[model samples]
Target: MAANILTDPGLMPELRRVDHGFFGPDSVAWRVWTHPSILIGLQRAVAVQFLNPFFTAAHDDAQAIYKYPGHFYDMTLGFLLSGILGDSRTALQTSDFIMRIHTRATGIEPISGRRYHANNPETQLFTHIDGWQSMLKCYEVFGPGPLSPADDHRFWNECATAAELFTCKPDDIPRSRDGVREYYATLRPQLCVTEAALSGMRQLLATSGPNSTAKLAAFSRFATPATLITLPSWMRRLIGFDQPAAVDRAYLPFMRGLLGTLNKSKRATRTTVRLAAPISGRILRQHWAAGTPRRAEVATVAEARKLYRQELRDENGFSSDTEYTAAH
Candidate 1:
């Protein structure tokens, strides 16, 4: 995939543009992603990054990050793999687990809120699972081989219960929200395995084939808009939502500068093809390689303990007697 991306004359320019946007000086996305304090601030920024489109659709950042040209790659590749590799069972299971996490993480009842949050992680996970089931159904209809029993029961059950909860219209429990806030405030921890799993998934899919690359590019594009829409409302308020002009004035110059660099590089006669392609490819490959699979990686709970122990060993670090809270 790296080799193809590097050698493809047509893709190099666009890929270069993407790299510039992600890594260049004007990159708000890069700035937030690489911040040292990846806590409330970064989380809020990320949420805003994903949700900018629904609230404000006038800018290039919204389009670039959320809705670009290639957007169906991941679903397509997943489907392709299931058809060819006979691993739909595994993919379905994996999708189910991720969907459950999404449900819990987003605090949304998956089945009832399915339509409104169709692009939400939880809904998307279910969609992926449904796709797998549909594939099984297709196999039953067309193929001579025996079809696998549908694994939809558990998912359906959960979704149904979630829908019932939604129908019940539970009263707004202020105390519950307060408790959640307190819990998160004390547990300043990152889900290391989740990060690792996503990373590994990307790497595995990237190395799969040219089709996989296309799938990834497509999936990212399609998923970007939903990400923007589902971002917390608070983030929009923080970024001077009322002062659109000011926000643009503060940020657009950087974007323009980066875009200019990309445009210049594309037109440069001396620019070698090999160098252009590999720069972004290397960065992406390294990122994916670092990610661990969900099944293989240590739990976040365990990783937090290890981090605490390392911190304790430092002379300037908090003393053993000092209490520490998990910071997500």
Candidate 2:
């Protein structure tokens, strides 16, 4: 049967509410959960980090860039897909969307004088680089399947051509500083075309029925776990869960609900979970590993669910157990 949620737009708002409750205000996590643009940028960054093992090796610098902006986008993509598909199309469409945005944002078109403060040159520039890097990574993975090598080369050429126009020294590319009107002007056309293309592509893909369904299913896996882990740390801490145990306590039910949902959803096929399990495990093990004291405190899946239900009783709130077991 077709999923009830596949065509529902109202669900987006509920997803946002869940996200807000998990991330909280004043935390860096809000930027990604609330903003589509920032979230796209982050997905691009994760694509880059995933493809380029160098970033993984350079963990400290990578974490610094990723924590605020990069992590936000990663979580956003994960959340969006989690709410939509889970892990079915993990990086495919997301990478495509981000690349399309990058292609337009960094192109040579002029920006209209009346744009938001956030759409200034610096933001566009940083987003451009992040997008280009991500697109390259996507090209490395899925691009080769549907696109010709010539197409890949041409795309990279366009990206390089755009990058050169806005840079001075080879390494000193202009980025979002304070008020970057000129940069925005340059990016306007590319951004417009890119967005249009993305819309068209989304529509076309959406109509493809089974393929679209499978892709979205793949995406959901990546989305759910990342949201369960990342958001609560920031939100609960903001809500006064200073102790690691308290923070973990607050996050238990949410995680269990998340995992249980994944286990039950029609989208949660073997391919989806199998593909996602390694990525999820790696992210959890990496962040929650012993080196980082805060991250180190996160519990395993079994432990998290047990504790989550315990806290549900303490708060006198019904747990998602009914839903969880019903799915089984």
Candidate 3:
């Protein structure tokens, strides 16, 4: 995408050996993230992300997505995949790459004249939490049904761990469903749809495979409403994504059937990879290529960070961002 953005850091060998980089293989994060249906949540999360006028304003000013939509998605998906599935080094570096990009995304909101920076902890926190919530909620609804209460708690706690990559303190993130609801409650009053945000939302929903083939176009058609229906009715209405209540009711069964059949066929994950390749392929494809190792060391995010900390030292002779790699 961006000329400075290095999609591959040549860490797949290490990534392949990592039994558990940050979240363990046994983690609720892995259980939820590995599902093909998580794409629905990711799509809807982008819509919700645009609801924050400031956040939308920052992105609108940057226009990175507008300039290079295909590369933009590829990088987004890459960051998500590497952070979730990569080794400590890969995950940490990918997070840094994203934050570095954010540092340049700054502008003043047109409506309130308030300054906005993508690196702001508040905006980053909203994005982090919304994405986790959307993916898990979508999985519960469309994929395998609800998780155990204990597992849900674990998932949210793991979300906090992942927040280390963002400007937010991991401790400030919610660790339970009730906590998340309360977190959003405080922000709800601050959120409103703006014309710019509405346009951005529509554009994000319209994304398709790079080829724009018929099948992919049809999938995009189905996916837009599918993601819209997953939003809370209030959110849907507020964002102008509301559908007829009857359509909402009817689509649920159809989606459940479609996603269920795919999951059962064991082709869902592979299909997701293929579909994502055109627009956003490298990171996910790399992760898929790495595959799961049967035996290797597992480490907590903190532990893994410490393990890789020395690897990133500038004195260690790594180049600047363009060629930085965990491999030495």
Clashes of each: 18, 22, 1
Task: Using TM-score as the measure, name the better of candidate 1 and candidate 3.
Answer: 3
TM-score of each: 0.20, 0.24, 0.85
- Higher-scoring candidate on lDDT, 2 or 3: 3
Q: Candidate 2: where is the Cα deviation over 4 Å?
A: 1-171, 175-182, 190-200, 203-281, 290-328
Deviation from native of the Cα of residue 26 in model 1, angstroms? 49
RMSD (Cα, Å) for all candidates, in order, is: 20.8, 23.6, 4.4
Q: Model 2: what TM-score?
A: 0.24
Name the best candidate (by lDDT): 3
Candidate 1 lDDT over residue span 1-328, tens digit each:
0222222334322222212211133322222222211111212222222222211222121222223222222232222221211111222222232222223232222223322322343333323332323332222222222322232333222223222111121121112223324533342231112232333223322223333345444433332322223223443343322324454454444433433343344233112211222233332333223332223321222232344344322322222333211101
Task: Give a tens-digit lDDT track for model 2, residues 45-67.
Answer: 44322222222222322232223
How many backbone clashes are present in model 1? 18
Query: Poorest 10 consecutive residues of model 1 by lDDT?
Result: 165-174
lDDT of each: 0.27, 0.31, 0.71
Error of 2 at 306 (Å): 48
Highest TM-score against the true fold, candidate:
3
Give the candidate order by descending lDDT: 3, 2, 1
